[model samples]
Each structure stands twice: as C-alpha cells, then as structure tokens.
Target: MNASAKRLVFLLLPVLATGCARTAVEPAMSRPDFVRGEPRVTVHRDHDDLLSAGLGLAGLAGTPVPFADPAHPTAPELRRRAIQASWKGIADLGPLGGYGQAYGAVPAVPGREYQAFAWVPGARQPHRVLLQVPDGFDQAKRCLVVTASSGSRGIYGAIALAGAWGLPRGCAVAYTDKGAGSGFFDYADDSGVALDGRRARRGEAELEFTPPPLSAGAGVAVKHLHSGDNPEADWGRHVLQAARFGLAMLDRAYPEQAPFTPQNTHIIATGLSNGGGAVLQAAGLDDAHLLAGVVALEPNVQLAGQGRPFYDYATEAAIWLPCALTDASFDATPFARAPMTRGWPQRCASLHAQGLLTAATPAAQAAQAYEHLRAAGWTDNAMQVAATTTAFDLWRAITAGYASAYLRRDAAHMPCGFRYAGMKADGQPGVADTATRAAWWSDSAGIPPGNGIGLLGGTDASTDPTLAGERCLRALWDGDGADSRALRAGIDATAARLPRTDLPLWVVHGADDGLLPTAFTSEPYVAWLRAEGRRPLYWKVPHAQHFDAFLPLPGFGERHLPLLPYGYAALDRLWAHLYEGAPWPTQSSTPKGQPRGARSLTPAMLGLGAN
Candidate 1:
C-alpha cells in the first residue's frame, strides 16, 4: 500500500460508506410485503428479554440483568462460586494465536485461567486445557459441559464463551486447543502427527506450544476435521479427544465434589460453528454414551453434511465465489451485476499478468481460475483475503438491494476494494491498513496473542458468502467426477456415522444470521433430521443475525442483540428435559414481544433485510 492504496481508499470509502448511510426501514423479509407466504412465527420473550436493553456486542459496559429467579441459581452467584473454586496447579499454557490481518489481538477473559493438561489427540509436545468450575457444582445436580473452540484462534473461542455464558451458569467447563486455529499443522507433513510451530514470514508464523506439566504420554494425532483444513472429520479428532479427555478429567477430579462420574454424571458437548459440529460428531461417534446431548449453534457443513453442497475444490474456490464477484445486484436472480463495471476486469488483468488469473472460456471457469491462482501465489492467506473481499462486496450489494427494494435506496451505494487488502489489513470493520505506513506495521507488531492478528478466521468473513455462488452450485448440483466423489466422501466421513441414537440434539439459527445462512448451514441438517424422524429441536430466531444471540451488536454500540439469552434459556430447558425429566420450554415472542409460534423456515421467513 503506497500512495495509490491511499488514493484508492479515499475514492472507495465514500462509496462504501453509502451502503451504511441509507436510513430507511426495510421490510424484515427478503420478499415484498404483498407477497402471500406463510405466517411469520411469533417468538416469546422467556428468559432473554433483557439483552435488547442496551447491551453492546462486547457486553462490556453493563451488568447482565439477573434473568434467573431469586430461588434459582443466578449467574452472579455462579460466578462467585467459580471465583472461589480451587486452583491446584497453574502452568504456562502459552499463547493462543491471534486472528489474521486487521482484526486486533484476541481479548483475554477476566476470569479464565489456563491449566496444564496433556489431553489433545495428536502431538509430541503436551497441550494445556482451560477449566473452570462453579462453586456449588456437584455431580448429582450439575453435569460437566465441554465446549469446543470454534474459530482458528483456538482457545480464544473457549475463553470468550466460557466467560460470557458457561462459567456464569456454575457448571464445570473445559476446552483444548484445536491445532488448525493456529495454523500449526502442515498438510504436507507425512509423519501423520507432523506440526510446525516455527514462526516465519508474512503468511507463516511460528505457533506457540507449551506442554502440560504432567506427561500424558505421546498425544494422539488430531483427526482431519479438527484441523480446519481439507474438512476431514467434522470437529476433527483433536477436539473429540480433548472433549472426551475433559469429561474424563471432570469425572476423576470432581467425582466427590460433583456428579463427575463416568456412568452417572451427564456430559454435554456444545459449541458454535466448528465447535458446534464437533459436539455433533462426538455424540455420533462416541458409542459409549460419553456425551448425552449436543447443542450445535450453526455448525459448519462438514459436521452436519448439510447446506448447499460443494463438489470439488475448484467449485468451492472458483465458480461459487466468482458468481458473487460478478453479481451486479442482489436480486433473487443473481445476475452478473458489476464485474467489469466495478473493478474485476482491471484486477483480473493484473492477476493475469502476474500469472494469477488466466484467460479461459466460460465453461467451468471456476476450476480454471482456481488453478491459475494456485499456480501463481495464492496460499491460504491470499485466498482468505480474496474471499473476504468478495464476501464483503456481495453482502453490501445484497443489503443495498433489500434496502432499495423496500426502502427506495439505490443499490450502488459502495465501491469495492481496489486491491486485495492482503496481510496488510484484516477485513474486519475499523481496522486500518498497515501497508500504507511502514510505521503502522511496526507499531502493531508487538501486540498480544497474534501480535496484532486477531480472530479474523476464514469462516469469520467480514461479510457473508452464503448467497451468491449460484454458478458453482448449478455446475456442481449434478456433478459426479472423481474430485466430487472424493470431496463428498471427505464431507460424509466427517459427519456422525453411527446409527441415530436417543441422545438429544438441539439447533438454533438466526433468520438474519450474517455469518452463516440457515439455508446453507442448518436447513440441510433440519431436513435430514425430519427425514430420519429423530425428533430433534430446532429454532429460528427472526431479525437475529449471526452474533445477535452470542455476540453484542456492533452497529448498536452498547445495546445487546438479545438472541443469545433466548438460546441460553433454550439450552437450560433442553438440559432439564434430558437430565431432570422436565418438559421442554416452549414460548415465543417477536422482537417486540408479540406472541408467536415456530413456523416452517422459508426464504421469506428469513430476515434477510435485518442484516
């Protein structure tokens, strides 16, 4: 980023800012109000109503209003219990890597403390596990809950969730690092358990690995899915092993204190995204009833075998993404909107000259483009940056289209980025480009966790990629090539293969989920469950984006999105039903507290306009 990048930003920021400037109220649905469709489900405000009352996405400023009954256990009481819990051994667990690019260092939870433990499946070196237990946590009343780390920042995901939700509930919680989040494992390494933690140039940083104080023998090889590369096992073997080990440790260490017994105490696997999928995989694969239930929050496709399927690597890399890049508008028909007009022509030309993009016919061009890009210099880093840019452009277009359709705003409110922001700038909103100033790079180099690279994992796109990619979808819909078969097999392998059991499973998705769309992530699993007659519970929250329930809303600074409170309540109900024979909680309310009931999920039912 030289003078040209600055000039480009100046020219583009105004246009991009236009997308955020339109203040008109758009219809919550994707379609027009006049369109006849299923009745929108009404949601009830049970235990999570306070979230909408000024809690920001970070939930930093305000104390969470006490949602629990005075008689029932409260978060504050549970937190107090956690604070007083015993701390026998503390070790240097080392640092979890930061998210790449513009995202800042992963924040440390105030109460979370790392414990030395050798549990993860693969490794020559020991891995530490983070554990927190409620003060009154007992085996008879409270079950040990193991959460999976979702993003590549490894343990950061665990820290965030545990601090925000789990530990507050007074239950025992634990998580181990999934190697993939840190980009530690080498795909090219053939020794099976090969991992390189040495720091290197821009795209390659040495991962930190501190062994547990006590040797747990040579660690097992983390499975493919957990690595977050090649999508092998849904949550990966490392997560599964770590989860099981966490449970076993809970049973052994807290047996007298709580129902941490293997046969009696219930263990639940829970998490978001990859962690969510890992729980599902654990439930399916653990034949010994290691985990009694699963609460999967918008799991990745590899875990559930759901969503709009991709065939080959080429399809995922090429046509699927390029279609969105070419979209001129965000209408239902996804017509090529502005590839040539926006900036793809010039960008593609530059890439072509650099041997990154080649001239090819329109037939199955995605694969061709992928080959060229890979042949040139597109590593995981480059591809992630490109994907983030494409996703942002597409989300803006879609948001503008919905606004224009319902609020009378023009769709072209923003200009796309001129160059791949690359390692210089993360796609996260508000991050400054370090490439523009060498001093800026040096200034951020000493930051924590990732030294400045925050939790901007690949899946955590600055914008959504669920919608576009029609060309790739259409092309691969009936695909039957060797690559397709291999890809499908890999996906299928990651899913739970054991016969469906009595273990309970619950899934929740926000209609306005911006990170991963319900149609692509959860719908397929819901359909499969229905077909299998598994009787799993699923909820779709209207006007709720990806972070609404889990993360505070960034747009509305201090106001919480509130969906997660409901999700937590639902989890409680699910737990009670499974463990205590209590009936499942059933109540619904709209964002306005209007009474409502669950309805079939449809494109119209989804709150596309809310994002």
Candidate 2:
C-alpha cells in the first residue's frame, strides 16, 4: 500500500476496532460492580511474606531470604504436560510487523486445554512457559494473569505481591517465566574457539556498564568489551516477547475459572521500566480478554528535545540538516538529523537570539544533545550535514560514540537533562527562562521521585547479579525499535484520549532513574490528559528510581523532598481513584476544605495550606 493508504488504514483500524470493542459501560464511567471490600484477611505486610519461596517464587523477591514452598499447586507441571500432549494445537505467528510472534491456541480462551509458544527475535531459544494454578481454582470467583518484569520471575517477593496481592480476592493467579528462569542470569559460553584441538569455553560478560559516571577510562573499556550494539536492544526483545506470551497464556488460562467470560476476567497488566514499557505497548494495541487497565511504574520511553545541544544553533542545525557537516569519525550526522525536526533548530536559534546560549559551555551543552541521540542509538554520522563552515571540523576529533558514551554517563545521573541553571556554567540561567522553568516545573512537580525503593544500591532481587545477567542477555537479543515506538505512540494516544481536567496523576519515580526523566512518568501524559478533561492524581517518591518502586527495599530512607510518608499518602489518594472510582476529594475542594465540585483551583487556593 502507498504511504497515505497505509496511514489511513492504520488510523481507521483502531477506531473501528475501538467501536466494535467498546465496553458495555461508558469509558469514562469508573463505577464497577466488583468493588473490593476492606480486606477480610490482613494484607501481606512485607514483600517476603506474600509468596511461598523456592523455585515456586517467580520474579524478583524484595529482600534476600531462604526459598519458600509454592503457595499454589504445581500447575506449571500440568501445563507443561498439557502442552506436550497437544503440541500440534499451537502455531507460531508473527505480529506487529514481525517484531515478535504469538502462539495461537485452538478456540482462543474458555477452552479446557491450552496451547501457546513464546517468540523473541534474536534469542537463541524461545522462552519456556511455566504456569501456576492457585489453590481452590475450581471454587474461585475470578481468574487473574500477572505479567512480571525481568528478575521478577523466580523471585518470591515480586511474585507474591503481583500474584498474591495484586489479584483481587477470590481470584486465581498465573504468571510466566519472563525468560529469566531459576532467578539467575544465563551465561553463554563459546565452544568454537579451541586450543590443541580441544574446545575452549569462555563465559561471556553480560553486565553492561552500570548506569553512568564511568571512570575516565570506563568508556574505552566498555567499547572494547561490550559486543552488543545497543544495550536496550539486547534485553528489550525478550521482555517484550515474554510479556506477549504471558498474555497469550492468559487467554488459555482464563477458561478454567468460575466466572470465565471475557468481560468478567480482570486482566491488570503492570511492570517496571522495561516491563512497564511492555504494559503500555500491550495496552495500546491489544484490547481483548480482561485487560481491565494498566499500571506502568517507571517506563523508559525516550523523551528528548527538552534542552539545548552543545553546538551553537547555526552549527548544530547545519550538522543536523540534510548532509554530513561534522568531521566525527563515526557517521552520526544521519542518526542525529533524523527524528529531530527543523523546528528544534529554529527553537534553539530563537532561544539563542534571546541570549539563552550563554547558559553552559559547548562541552556540557553538546554532552546533553549527544546523550539524547546516543541513547536512541543514533549518531552524528547518521545525520546528513553540509560542510559550509569550519563547524564540522570542531566535532571531527569528538567521536559520536565517544560523545554518546559521555552522555550516557550524564544521563545515568539525571535522565531528564540538567535543569536550565544546572546545565549552565556559572549556575547562571541559560535555558531557565520563564517559559523553560514553567515547562520544567510543570513536568517535575506532578511526578514525585519514589523513595526507599530497593532496586537501587543493588539491594532488590530484580537487581540481583544473576538477574542482571539475564536482563543483559535479553537486551542483547531483542531488537529495540518496535518496543520504543510502540511505547511512545501508546503514551501519546492514551494522552490524546483522556478527558481534560487538572486532577493530578500520582506518579512514582526512582531518584536514580537512568533512562527517561522523572517527568516522563505519566505526569506529562497526565497533564496532556488533563487538557482533554481527565483528572490525574500525580505524586513521586524520593530515591525511587525507575523499576525500584516495583522492587521495594527494607529501611531505606526516602530520597526526595516530601519523603516516604507523603508519598504513601499520595498513593492512598490514587488508590481511592482506582478502587472507589471517585474523583480525588481534593480535586473539587477549596483551600478551606469546602467542596467546590470539579471547579479548577486558583493559584491562591492551591498556594494556601488548606485543603
């Protein structure tokens, strides 16, 4: 099909599908018949107590401890036997442009027997499926499918929270391996290289450089040691495939429970960082089954263009334009030029004309731009630049890869790019113009950093050395393009569909988030959603970086300004929205605690301590 035709089909398909699949209730109506009552049993207090330990624990456990017995039956064994019995019933099928494949089961859902396969593009082997059947499944009122993130599989803590806690009362739960079985990273050894006619095996290094601040020599060492072209590509695919497979498995598993209809099955998908991205992508594309809602704790969708580049507006513009203008050994010009629009240069020039260029030195400024492009795996050599001026010569000695390495380091420290003043040389305002500050504060204030999350400082099971290796392997194997675009589009589309309102979206971010900025957390999307009449309940926790919220640590202090207590309160209010389906009480309340009934708050009212 022609480009226009393809675009038309793409746009029409979702609308048509959306119309046909429209829920019985209005999309905006939050009320549901299944309101959860106060817990009949005490909620699992700490992460460790939720799931039975041992291989039974699938996914990241919070703190290190002995393995517990399986709380649920060994349905995984039964499922394996079932798959073996009806192997011919399943077929591998590709979807979303062959980015991944789906295993189809005969009769889809509500079938007694299940058939499914896991497909990831570059993995040497497809992920194996493991299933767990909750106790008294035949007696349960509902069924749930929990999808886990990397390191989450095989870890007792994460599984318990997701499977035990996340599942509504009277529901049976099942989860997948997420391609990381045994709670450890897989090690690949090369058998081809040999000495004295004997095969020699060497353990491949799987851990990529930890999020930045690399020693001065670390970059060179990494370049020489690391084999994967893009770290994200390495692990992203497995996670995507595993997630997709998990959903398919759910389709089969859903049939066994009491309330087996599609409408009644509650499919709540969630994940942290990579897994979070998977949740967003899956939600945007698939509406089948019981995909009730999505909760992405800390997703990593690239959000650039918020700051200025290192080169002056004219020079960078020329470099980012239609030809190669930079002399950098690595041809990043093309990659840099793509994705960036002409408007970026224009905006930069406008800012420069207004004296915003004096904010930071060329090196620091260039570092920010370089980091953004590099993370996306695009280099200056990829851009088409012209050699009109001596500008390209300056960048010649500075390799795109080298620049990218430096930028990655910087990104690890502050993924959002430094605040305007922070990016400046003398702490003088560069991009901190009122407009910039407004944008920054607008995005920052809504998503508070998560505090005391265990994923940081290597305490969380998700960050277990063994799990990290598995994650690295997954990243190395999965191609990155499909997941990235899917996440971006999903967020944008979700934002577009929301009703306009100023209600905050309670967002949690790890203070150590290395991928996207904390602002990228549903805040901007929520803000955009508010513009469409939707109210978001936004909040953040300190030291809770991406993925950390999913992996809580014990006794770590809150790392942000408002700290943990305030963070929990914010979460409580958000939970009200999710459970009670009521607009935040504060949303319509005046400063004096008087009800205002959906009226937007005034600056004075918000500024006042009341309400």
Per TM-score, the best of the predicted structures is 1
Candidate 2 lDDT over residue span 1-611, tens digit each: 24432222111110010111111111121111211111011111112112331112121111112112111112222122112211111111111111011111111111111112243444322233323333233333344444443322221112322443333233333343333222111011111111111112233222211222333212111211122222222233333343333334344444343224435544445444444444444443453323544445545433223221121122233233212221233233222332322233333333334353432443333444444444543333222222111121212111221122222222222211111011223444222222222111101111111000001111124312222222222222232555334323322322212321332333334433322334434445545545556554444333333322211111111221111222223433444454468665434321121111233222222122332
* lDDT of each residue in 438-555, candidate 1, tens digit only: 1111111111112222222122221323223322232323368653454455445556543264767777665544345565566677667667766667766554444321221112
What lDDT score belongs to each candidate, Candidate 1 first?
A: 0.36, 0.28
| Backbone clashes (count) for model 1 | 31
Off by over 4 Å in 1: 1-128, 136-140, 183-240, 251-255, 303-307, 310-489, 498-500, 547-563, 578-580, 585-611
List TM-score per model, in order: 0.50, 0.37
What TM-score does candidate 2 reach? 0.37
Off by over 4 Å in 2: 1-50, 54-117, 120-132, 136-145, 150-161, 167-170, 173-261, 287-290, 302-516, 528-537, 540-611
Q: Given candidate 1, what's the lDDT at residue 165?
A: 50
- Compare the candidates by lDDT and give the number of the best one: 1
